[model samples]
Target: MTVLVTGANGLIGRALCERLQQKKQAFRAAVRPGVPVQPGCDVAEVGELNQATNWCRALTGVDIVIHLAARVHVMHDKSADPLAVFRTVNVDGTLNLARQAVDAGVKRFVFVSSIKVNGEATKMGRPFTEADAPNPQDAYGQSKCEAEQGLRQIAMDTGIEVVIIRPPLVYGPGVKANFAALMRAVQRGWPLPLGAVHNQRSLVALDNLVDFIITCMTHLQAANQTFLVSDGQDLSTTELVRGMAQAAGVSARLLPVPVWVLQAGAKLLGKGDAVQRLCGNLQVDISKARDLLGWVPPVSVEEGLGRCVRG
Candidate 1:
C-alpha cells in the first residue's frame, strides 16, 4: 500500500516518515513547493494547501493519505478574521483534499487533529473521551472540529474510510514552542513558580503517535472512528518539570507558589492563557484506543523525554 504523507517535514510528519522508511513502507512525502524533500523518499511538490490547491500529482496510486498539514494554532495571531484564516486551510483545504482523495481511489484518510477540539481544559479526574461533545475555544480548534465534521459527511457520502486521531501535547526530538522553552528553562536552572500547582496533563510522544497512526492506516477497527491518543500516563506540571530536569541531568528549581497567586499574577500580566496552560488539567482518556486497537505506547515518557533533551 502506498501511503501519501502531507507535511512530511514537520515534527510529527518527520518522525512518522522516518518510522515508515525504517519499516520499508511504500509511501510518498507530499511537501509544499520549494520545501526541500526529505532524503531517500519519493516526494511530490504540492504547493500551498487551500481549497483550490491541486493534489492530483500527490494522490496518484496512493492507497492511504495521512493529512497532517494545517494552519497550526498561533499565540498572537494578527489576522483580522482568525476563524476565516484557519478555515481557509484547516477546514476548506482539508475537505478539498479529502474529496479529491476519494476521487483518486484512496481507501483511507487519517487526519491528525488536536486535543483542543475537546476544549481548553478538563475538570480534574474527568478526562476527555471521544464521545464528549466538542467545545472548541479558539479559531484553530474550531477549524479542526469543523474539518472533522466535514470529513464525516464526506465519508458517509463517498464510502471512504476516515480515521481521526486527536492527540494532546506531542513532544519529542525537534520539538519547538512552549515545550522547547520549558526544556531550555530547566536546562538553564531557571526557578519556576509551579511547584505547588497540581494539575494533570496528557501528552503523546512522537514515536507513540506515529505508531498509532501507522496502525490506523490499515486497521479494520479504526475505519470511520475517532480516537483520543496519549502516552497512557498523566503528569502534573511539577512532575513534568522534574522529569525534564532528570532527563537533562540537571536540578530543577521549582518554587512552591500558590496556584491562586500565580493565576492572579498571570491575569495582571496579561498571561492568563499561558499560565492556564501551565497550571491546568487537560487530560484525555485513552481507554478507547487501548480497548479497540490493543495498542500500547512503545516508548515510555521517561525515554521519550531523554531522547528529546539529549537530541
Candidate 2:
C-alpha cells in the first residue's frame, strides 16, 4: 500500500518515516516548503498546511493518508485569536486534506489526534476511554475535536475509512518541551518540589505510537475506530522524575512540598494550567486497542525512558 505521511519533519513523523523505510514500506513524505527533503525517500513539498494549501502532489496515487500535521498546542500562545488560528490549520486544513484524499481515491485516512480531545485531565481512577464524550478544554483540543467530526462526516459521505488515534504526552528519543526540560533538570541535579505529589499520568513512547500507527494502516479492525494509545504504564510526577534520574545514573533530589502550596504558587504566577499538568491525573484506557487490534506497546516504560535519556 502506498502511504502519504504529512508533517514528515516533525518528531513523530521523522521516527515514523524511518520505521517505514526500515520496513521497506512504499510511502511518500510530505514536508513544508524549504524543509530539506528526507534522503532516500519519496518527498513532496506541500507548502503551508491550511484550507487552501494544495495537497495534490502529496496525495497522488496514495492508498492511505496519515494526517499528522496540525497546529499543536502552545503553552504560551501569542496569537490574537488562538481558537481561530487553531481552527485554520487543525480543522479547516485537516478536512481539506481529507476531502482531497478522498478525491485521490485514498482508501483510508489515519489522523493522529491528542488526548486533550478527551479533556485536560480525568478524575482519579476514572481513566478516559473511547466511550467518553469529547470535553476539549483548550483551543487546540477543540480544533482536533472539530476535525474528527468533519472527518467522520467525510468518511460517511465518501466511504473512505477513517481511523483516529489519540495519544497522551508522547515521549522518547528527541523529545522536547516540558518532558525534555524535566530530563535536563534532573540530569543537572536540580531539586524538584514534586516528592509528595502523587497524580497518575499516561505517556506513550514514540516507538510504540509509531508501531500502533503502522498497525492501523492495514488492520481491518482499526477502520472507523477511535483509539487511545499509551505505554499502558502510568507514573506519578515524582516517579517520573526519579525514573529520569535513574536513567541518567543520578540522584533525584526531590523536596517534599505540599501540592496545595505548589498550586498556590503557580496560581500567583499565572502558571496554574502548567502546574496542573505537572500535578494532575490524565490517564487513558487502551483496552480497546489491545482487545480490538491485538496491539501492545513493544517498549516498556523503563526502556523508553532510558532511550530518551541516552539520546
Candidate 3:
C-alpha cells in the first residue's frame, strides 16, 4: 500500500499529502532538486525529472505512482519554443518516469491531467464532456494531451495499470494562480465588474481531487481508464465572485458591467489573454467518473471556496 507522490510541494500535491497522512498511508514524496521537501512525509529529490537516471530510485518499493510533476506556467509563455520545452518536461519526462516505474514493478500509475485536453470553454453555454475530442488550444494543454497519448501507449506495451484523472480548475486553501489572485482582490475589497458575466465553469476542491486520486489507486476498474472529475457543480462568474466575497467576509457589491466591455477593455489594453480566461466557459461533465468509479465529490463548492477565502 505504499505510494509515491511527485510534486508533493505543489498546491494539489500538498493537499494530497495531507490526505494520505490523515489516512495513515505509507507514502513517499518526490520533488525536483532545489524545491523544499514536504513536511511529515518521506521525501526524495529525483534530480531532473527529464533525466531517466536515478528515476528508478524513487520507484523502488513504490506500489502506486501519482505523477503530478510537470511544467506549468500561469501566463502566455514568453519562450520562443514553448512546446519544445513543454515536451521535454511534460511529455518526454512523463514517459521516462512511466517506463522506469514499469521496470520497478509498480502496480498502478495515476496521472493527474488537465481538462483543457477537451478544450477551454469559449462560450458560457458550451461545456466540454468526456465524449468531446481533444482540441487543446495552448502549449500547456497540448503537451498534456500528448502526454496522455504517450502514457496510453506505454500502458498498452507494459501492462502496467494507468489511471488518468483530468480535473478542471481546482481550488482550496493555499491555492495559487488565478484562484489566489481572486482571493487577494476580494480580501482587499477591490471592485470587480465580473458580476455581469455569466460564464459557468467546473471546479474541484483539493480534497475531492485527492479522494478521487486515492480511489483510482489499485481500483480494479480504473486500470487503463481515463476519467474527468470535478465537484459535480458549475458556478457562474457572478455567483463565484459573490461566494468568494462572502467567504472572505467582504461586501457582495459586485459590479454588473457588460461582458463585451470587459473584452473591449482587455483588447485595447493588451490584456486580451486575461479576457479569454475571465470570460471563458471552462466546464466539464463528471457523469463518467460517477458511473465508472462509483465516486462522488464530498466537498460542496461553497465549502471549498470558503477554505480558499479564509486562507
Candidate 4:
C-alpha cells in the first residue's frame, strides 16, 4: 500500500519511516522546508501546515496518511492566543488535510494525538482509558481534542477511515525535553529531590509507538477507533530516576523531600506546572488496543531506556 507520512523529520516520524523502510513498505515522506528527509525514501517538501495550505502534490497516489504535523505547545508560550494558533494547525489544518485526502481517494488516516486529550493527570491507581470523556486542560490538549472531533465528523461525512492513537510521554533515542534532561542529570550523577514523589506516569518508546502506528495502518478492527498506547509499564518519579541512573551506569542520589513541601516550594517559585509534571500521576489503560488490535509493546522499558542513554 502506498502511504504518505507527514512530519517525516520528527522524532516518531523518523523512526516510523525507518521501520517502514525495513519492512520494505512503499511510502513517501513529507517534511517542512529546510528539514532533511530520510535518504533513499521518496520525499515531498510541504511547507507550513495551515488552512490555506494545499496538499495535492503530497497526496498523489497515496492510500494512507499518517498526520503528525502540528503546532505543539510551548512551555512558556508568549503568544496572546495560544488556542487560536493551535487550532489553525492542529484543528483546521488537520480537517483541511482530511478533506483533501478524501478527495484524493485515500483509504485511511492515522492521527498521532496526545494523552492530554483524556486529561492532564489521573487519580492514583485509576488510569485514563478511551471510554472516558475528553477533558483537555491546556490549549494544546484542547486543540488535539478538537482535531479528534473534527476528524470523527469528517469520517462520518466521508467514507474514509480515521484512527487516533493517544500516547503519553514518548521517550527513546533522540528524545528531547524533560526525558532528555532527566537522563543528562542522571548521567552527571546529580542529586534529585524525587524520592518522596510517588506519582506514576506512563511512557511509550519510539519503537513501540511506531509498531502500533503501523499496526493501525491495515488493522480492520482499528477503523474509526481511538486507542491509548503505552509501554505497559508504569514508573514513579523515584523509580524512573533510578532506572535512568542504572542505564547511565551511575548511582541515583535522591533526596527525600516531602511531596507537599516540593509542591509548596514549586508554587512559590512559579514552577507549579513543572512540579506537577515531575510528580504527576498520568497512566493510561491500553487494554482496548491489546484486545482489539492484538498489539503489545515489543520493547521493555529497561531496554528502551538503555537505548535512550546509549544513543
Candidate 5:
C-alpha cells in the first residue's frame, strides 16, 4: 500500500522514513518547499499547513495518510492569538487533509497527537488512559483535541478509518527542545536541582513510536481507536538526569533543593510552567496499546537514553 507522511523532515519523521526505507516500504514524503530531502524521494511540496492549504496532489493514490504536520507547541509563543494560530493549522488543516483523503478513497488516517490532550499532568499514581475525558490545558492541546473530534466525525460521515495515538515526551538521537537541552546539560555535568523532586513521567522512544505508527497503518483492530503509548517504564526527574549523565560519561551533580522551594522560585521568576514540566507527575497508561494490539516498546529507556546521549 502507498503511504504519505507529512512533516517528513522532522525528528520523528526522519527516523520513520529511515525505518520505512530499510523495510522497503512504498511511501512519499510531504514537506515544505526548499527543504532538503534525500535524493529521488517521492516528495510533495505542500507549503504552509492551514485551513486554505490544498493536499489533493499529495493524497493522490495514497492509501494511508499519516498526519504529523501541525503547528507544534511553542515554549514561548509570540503569536498574539495562540489558539487561533493553532486552530488554523492543527484543527482546520487536519480536517482539510482528512476530508480530502476520504474523497481520495484513502482507507486509514493515523494522527499523532500529544499527551497534553489528556491533561498537562496527572495526579500522583493516576496515570492517564484512553478512556479519560479530554482536559486540554493549552492551545496546542485544545487544537489536537478538536482535531481528534473532527476526525472522528469525518470517520463517521465518510467511513474512512481513523486511528489516534497520543504520546508523551518523545526522545531519541535527534531530539530537540527541552529534552535535547536536558541531554546537553547532563553531558556538561551541570548541577541540576532535581534531587528532591520525585515525580514520575512517562516517555516514548522515537523507535518505539515509529514502530507503533507502522503497526497502526494496516492493523484492522486499530481502526477507530485511540491509543496512549510510552516506553512502558516511568522515571523520576532525578533518575532520568542520572541516567542521561551516566550515558554521557559524566557525574550527576544534583542539588537537594525541596520541590516547594523550586516551585516558589519558579513562580518568582515567572517560570512556573517550566518548573511544572520539570517536576511534574505526568504518566500515561499504555495497557490498551499493549493488551489490544500486543505491541511493546522495542527499545528500553536505558538504550534510548544512550542513543540520545551519544548523539
Candidate 6:
C-alpha cells in the first residue's frame, strides 16, 4: 500500500519515514515551506494547504495521508491573532487535505495531535484517558481540537477511517525546540537546582512513536479510534534530566530546590509558564492501545534517551 507523510522532514516525520523505509514499503512525503527533505524518501511540495491547487496534485495516487503539518506555537510569536492563524493552517488546512484524501480513495488518515489538546492538567496525578474530556487551554491545542472535530465529521460522512495519536513531550535523536535546549544544557553541565521538584510527565521516544504510526497504518482496530501514547511509562522531571545527563556522559548538577520556591521565583521574573512546564502535571494512560491493538512500545525510556545522547 502507498502512504503519504506530511511534514516528512520533521523530527517525528523523519523517524517515521526511516521506519517505513526499513519495512520496504512504498511511501510519499509532503514537504511544506521552511521544512527540508531527508535523503532517499520521495519528496513532493505543496505550496499551500488551503488552496485547491495545493490539494489537487499531492493527493494523486495517495492511498493514505498521515497529516502532521500544522502551525506550531512558539514563545516568539508576537501576533495577536495566533488562534486565527492556527485555525487557518491546522483546522482548515488539515480538513482540506483530508477532503482530498477522501476524494483520492485513501483508506486511513492518521493525525498526529498534541497532548495539550486535552488541557494542561497538573499535580492531581491522574492520567488522562481517551475518554477524558477535551479541555484545551491554549490556541494551538484549541486548533488541534477543532481539527479532530473536522476530521471526525468527514470520517462519518465519507467512511474514511481516521486515527488520532496524541503524544506527550516527544524527544529523541535530532530533536529540536525544548528538547534541543535540554540537550545543550546537559552537555554544558548546568548546575540546575531542580532535583527537589517532583512532577511526572509522560514522554514518548521517537522510535516508539514511529512504531505506533506503523501499527496504526494497518491495524483495523485503529480506525475511528483516538489513542494516547507514550513509552507506556512516566518519568519525573528530575529523573528525565538526570537520565539525559547520564546518557550524554555528563553529570546532572541538580540541586534540591523546592517546587514552591521555583514557582515564586518564576512569578517574580514573569516566567510563570516556564515554571509551570518544568513542574507541571502532564501525564497519560496508554492502556487502551495495549489492550486493543496488541501493540508494545519498542523502546524503553532509558534506551530512547541513550540513543538521543549518542546521536
Question: What would the TM-scores of all predictions be?
Answer: 0.99, 0.98, 0.96, 0.99, 0.98, 0.96
Candidate 6, residue 236: lDDT: 77
lDDT of 5 by residue, 1-311 (tens): 89999989998888888888889999999999999777657899997988788888898989999989888999899999999999999999999999989989999999999999999999989999999999999999999999999999999999999999999999998898989888888888888888888999999989899999999998889999999999999999999999998888889989999999999999999999999999999999999999889898999998989988777
Which candidate would rank higher by TM-score, 4 or 5?
Answer: 4
CA lDDT of 27 in candidate 4? 97
- Report lDDT (CA) for all predictions: 0.95, 0.94, 0.85, 0.93, 0.92, 0.87
The best-first sequence of candidates by lDDT reads 1, 2, 4, 5, 6, 3
lDDT of 4 by residue, 174-243 (tens): 9999889988998998888888888999999888999999999999999999999999999998999999
Clashes of each: 0, 0, 0, 0, 0, 0
What local lDDT score does residue 251 receive in model 5, on the 0 to 100 scale? 94
Clashing pairs in 3: none
Cα error, candidate 5, residue 206 (Å): 0.8
Q: Candidate 3, which segments miss by more than 4 Å at Cα?
A: 51-53, 122-126
- Cα lDDT of model 1 by residue, 1-311, tens digit: 89999999899999999999999999999998788756999999987789999999999999999999999999999999999999999999999999999999999999999999999999999999999999999999999999999999999999999999999999999999999999999999999998998999999988899999999999999999999999999999999999999999999999999999999999999999999999999999999999999988999999999989987
Model 4 C-alpha lDDT versus the unseen true structure: 0.93
Error of 4 at 175 (Å): 0.9
Best by lDDT: 1
Tens-digit per-residue lDDT, 1-311, candidate 3: 79999989898888889889999999999987778855777887777667454776677899999999988854867888998888888898998899899999998899998887888774556667767889998889999999999999999998988999898888888888877887788778888888898787888998889899999986788998889898988888888888888888888667899999999999999998777777777877788878887998988988888877766
RMSD of 6: 1.4
TM-score of candidate 1 on Cα atoms, chains taken together:
0.99
What lDDT tens digits, residue by residue, belong to model 6 across residues 199-265? 8889899989999988998898999999999998887789989999988888899989999999999
Worst 10 residues of 6 by lDDT: 48-57
RMSD of each: 0.7, 0.8, 1.4, 0.8, 0.9, 1.4
